[model samples]
Target: MCRNWGGGPLLVVECESDVSFSGEENIGLYQSSQWAERGFCKQCGSHLFYKLKQNNQYFIPVGLFDNCEGLVFDHQVFIDEKPKYYCFANQTKNLTGAEVFAQFAPPE
Candidate 1:
């Protein structure tokens, strides 16, 4: 379970494979218009959460939270870009690239 500094929603993700990373390298994807902030476990280097900069919302990969209980997903973004190797069996709303950009685009 992952929580922000304010102790609000607990972000959860299940890990499909082990992820190892050095502390010095950046763990997230960011650009001029979009950002996908990521958090990792310091001890085991596990990917924790992916946060959106536009709405201050977050999404957990669900793979890292295998044992996590009672968590809900509001939606899923980048469904089209999702890797073909894996599939999420849940029935949450999946957002396309254009839909996500329109909704989360930076204000003019």
Candidate 2:
């Protein structure tokens, strides 16, 4: 996340289904990891979403939405990798990178 998202905490909305884009020509995809890819806007270089290679799951940055009325900051991932300079006051579920992989990684 840090390597792709300009080295900061990125708030993303995880979607279980495929996210449709109106301007497909402006979207650029980079294979960020073995299991996923990151999408960006080619015209403005704005980071779009991180998508799983194995599924339709997409982690779209919350900032892209026009209205954030119902969104909740209930959980966080890669807690161990978060920079020590910033902190959150919310009493939410947090998971380390290893814990995330353990819970979501497919059985081999």
Candidate 3:
């Protein structure tokens, strides 16, 4: 829902597609019939995640974690598209739009 998202660090978790998370209250879920599902916390308006239904895999904003001690930064996608407002100090395999699609996009 937002671009050049929060200025703080974000944590992204990729898990097996069958996994799911349910919130007890103030939750929002949106989906398109065949591709993906999105969720958010309605009360606080926090973007929860984006899940690809075909694989049951989801991308979550890691800042949502209470404790993220084990997380590590490896590669970064859309590295070329990141706004000038932020920068990362760590060395990572930064990929541009074409590279990302080439590696992850399903064959056409």
| Residue lDDT tens for model 1, 1-108 | 122321333334433234454554555443323454666665566555556665556555556555656666656666776656766667888888789778866755
Model 1 ranges with Cα > 4 A deviation: 1-34, 63-75, 82-92
**Candidate 2, 28-100: lDDT as tens digits:** 9998877788899999999998887777688898999999999999998999888789999998999999998
Model 2 RMSD in Å is 1.5
| lDDT score at residue 56, model 2, on the 0-100 scale | 60
The residue pairs in collision within model 1 are 13-62, 13-64, 13-65, 14-62, 14-63, 14-64, 14-65, 15-63, 15-64
> Between the candidate structures 1 and 2, which one is better when assessed by lDDT?
2
C-alpha root-mean-square deviation, each candidate = 10.4, 1.5, 3.2
Q: Give candidate 2 regions above 4 Å deviation.
A: none
Error of 1 at 37 (Å): 1.3
Best by lDDT: 2
Q: Tell me, by TM-score, which candidate is best.
A: 2
Residue 6, model 2: Cα distance from true site in angstroms: 2.7
Error of 3 at 61 (Å): 0.9
**TM-score of each prediction:** 0.46, 0.90, 0.72
lDDT of 1 at 17: 33
